[model samples]
Target: MSGGLARCSGSPDRDPGLQPERTRLAWRRTTLAVTVASVLAVRTALHGRAGSGELPAVACAILAWLGFVVVAHQRIRALSTPRPPLLTHRAALLTAICAALVAACGAALVG
Candidate 1:
């Protein structure tokens, strides 16, 4: 008996394992970190004295966070299925590129 548990949409089998849950949580956590970084970048921009590249760095930070959110949301949705597909190279590359952009903004703010 499923004990009143509702089957997840598009998941044919009832998975007893927590692997999918764990993966979803990990994605959420990473997204949260990126969100925090983006907020910090904005705060720094507002408080710090104006610099030549500061506005661009803050804009990039916001755009990168948006990109990561989109990618993470898709990955999280895919993981909901019982047999989630493997991460595509395109998705992986996009995530990495977004992360690098955020990091570059941080470094630029510091310098």
Candidate 2:
């Protein structure tokens, strides 16, 4: 156990906090959201409405997914670097920004 991986020395039947799982789920959720937006954008574009609201929605979704990817990579790096808190904070901030971007896109679509 001298390398750098986080230890799971207690019991194998316990929850163990699930930090890695949460990070993976975050990535999955973001990716799904982006995919949905991309599909919608393509559909709208095919209908001759590319720059109305679908573009913004697609851009925001892609940006959010990219943020999630960054968070996932950071979490993996933290597994061997002892930098959990920093990665967690960055991920949270990125999520918040993505949420705001989504909201803004919604508002623009409304008006």
The Cα local distance difference test for each model comes to: 0.82, 0.54
When summed lDDT is taken over every stretch of 10 residues in candidate 1, the lowest stretch is 1-10
Superposed model 1: Cα runs more than 4 Å off: 1-5, 9-12
Show pairs that collide, candidate 1.
none
Q: 4 in model 2: Cα distance from truth in Å?
A: 13
Q: Per-candidate RMSD vs. true structure?
A: 3.8, 6.0
As for candidate 2, its clashing pairs are: none
Candidate 1, 1-111: lDDT as tens digits: 132224443356746775666677888999999899889888988888878889899999999999999999999888776667888999889988998999899899878
**lDDT, residue 109, candidate 2:** 47
- Cα lDDT for residue 21, model 2? 47
Per-model TM-score versus the true fold: 0.85, 0.46
Give the local distance difference test score of model 1: 0.82
Angstrom error at residue 34, model 1: 0.5
What ranges in model 2 sit over 4 Å off?
1-57, 76-87
